[model samples]
Target: MSLALEFVSTVRADRSGPVDTLADVDGLTSWARAHAAGPGFTASEEARQETVRLRQAVRALFARAVAPEPPSRADLPDLPPFKEALALVNATALAAPTAPQLSWDDKPVLVIAPAAETDEPTRLRARLATAAVEFLAGPEVALLRTCPAPRCVLYFVKEHPRQEWCSTACGNRARAARHYREHKK
Candidate 1:
């Protein structure tokens, strides 16, 4: 699965974050169901709030793992949702080895070669693991970065080492702002 999809999947309450207890996998199934129906599945106000909470919680968790900030592990709660998500993320991170090279295809495809293919979740996790490695290992890999768009936290492997924007939309906006400033001078 694509990084964006993976991110969405991880955040949804149906897939893996729904279970109240870490031992039960029902929460993951709930998350998957919620995710399949789309973000709008949060029909009620309470559900909406819960969805938002989950999204923020999951995003923070991922951001911290990929881009470590500080020592706040003590403040965290022992929630099953967090534990399950962290396990998935960590496992993926581990699977994502630092390969010296990656191949390019005319068709956009991400091939994941892992031990298990029977489980959809496992396959998804493995794919993410491969992607993490690819993002970390590719040329200009240092430039591999997440979208700076506030709500858009998707990752992209930059073709240029010095790339600052994830797309022309962002780059153009930044340039326009600069030009506006220059004209004000």
Candidate 2:
């Protein structure tokens, strides 16, 4: 899966509320390790906080993008979190030495590899941020969708024509709700 999608999947469903995977530094570290293709990332308290902030900003941006209408300039300015997240993403990309390199392999023919620098945490963030920017700016932004299941806060890219839910469980839940409503009547 793309980094943007993986980052968005850090949140899960709950009976009471949404469950955030990056609720702490350890969760953030686990997520980084799983998604990051580069060097081993050392998660710090600061990095975890920044990741949480960025996640919220990205969620807000996704919500706006999937809305029925565009937000006004006044509305945009009020989103200080989004602004700060964008700054961090831009700065990290600018500070990076070089983009990931491609190398030829006997089995796969070609492979893209990350830089061999020690700054794993920064690289991971930059890569994820870049993916998010690309996803939001590209034409596929239209595919960005939130799950329709009740109490579900997850987001997903619509990969198939009939794909309406994020997972089979969500689809089942929607079906069950529809059935209950019909039977109650």
Candidate 3:
């Protein structure tokens, strides 16, 4: 999965209700660490808010990317307008500028990386937004699907011809619900 997809998975629809995994500084810190490809970060109050805003924007865009298909239930109430979401992600991605550098030992490979002096929070947001933009434009967007299990609010890239729900647990939940409905009827 792309970093953007994992970032969006931070929010989930649980049995109790919708859950914002990045609900506070601690949550944000852990999520950043887990997702960080370069270096880990501890989120600040302002950083948390900004990160959440970016997440919302990405989710909103993802909702549209999977158009004609229902979006994650967790994102339903918080999705921003398509244009607004686009602007937010683009701005965030541009906030901390990156430059391309070539690294070669055996072969030459160029990498686009954020400026060294950029703060942790800003770098985090930029990386996330960049990943989201790439993911949305990439071919995998055609494979994204929102899980249909009872109370599921997760999206997944269909891995195979037969894949359905986002996870085994969600598939089980959906099966159970279908069984219950059939038996009840």
Candidate 4:
């Protein structure tokens, strides 16, 4: 499978870790180019800047998903358009317990937006934040998780039933640390 596919797959999986808001955008565009899925998406420097703006949005969504006190709609910024989009989506999700369906595959697919095309930083932030909330409401949104590795902020799904850390590197490091402690005794 392509890196984009892997990125999507990982996002849709179950695990606890910090969400990798934009790490896979370049890889995804690369894979999209290789697979001939139209021209590769070249995220402009503006997009990169937008991604930075989206960090707070994504983080806020994660906070809503895992944190106790989530921001209220009233607490949202004064930006009009993105906030409106967020309200629309958020209200829809709130009204419907089930996630919005996207693909027609055998398995249920929940639609979520990527931060790549957001033109306005404020709007992008709103979309990502809204998307995160929408994702959190879904039955399949176990996608939002924290890395089990002690200090690692990277997030990924728990592919295996017993998987924990976002990557095997973190898992190995943890295991090695355990071994060192035992052997030193």
Taking all chains together, each candidate's TM-score versus the true structure is: 0.38, 0.76, 0.92, 0.44
Q: Sorted by TM-score, highest first, which candidate order results?
A: 3, 2, 4, 1
Candidate 3, residue 36: lDDT: 66
Off by over 4 Å in 4: 1-40, 67-134, 159-161
RMSD of 4: 10.3
Provide the lowest-lDDT 10-residue window in model 2.
Answer: 69-78
Once superposed on the true structure, which residue ranges of model 1 sit more than 4 Å away at CA?
1-87, 90-117, 137-140, 146-154, 181-185
Q: What's the true lDDT of residue 115 in model 1?
A: 44
Worst 10 residues of 4 by lDDT: 4-13
Ranking by lDDT: 3, 2, 4, 1
CA lDDT, every model vs. true structure:
0.43, 0.69, 0.89, 0.45
- Give candidate 2 regions above 4 Å deviation: 37-39, 69-85, 95-97, 100-118
lDDT of 1 by residue, 1-185 (tens): 34433433342122232322112344444553443333322233343333334433444454444454321221135323556655545565554233333447776555534443333443433444444445334443444355553233344445676776556766776677778889995
| Per-residue lDDT of model 3, residues 53-113, tens digit only | 9999999999998889888888688788989999999999988899998999999999976
lDDT of 4: 0.45
Best by TM-score: 3
Looking at model 2, residue 28 earns an lDDT score of: 86
Superior by TM-score: candidate 1 or candidate 4: 4
- Residue 77, candidate 2: alpha-carbon lDDT: 46
Instruction: Assess candidate 3 and give its lDDT.
Output: 0.89
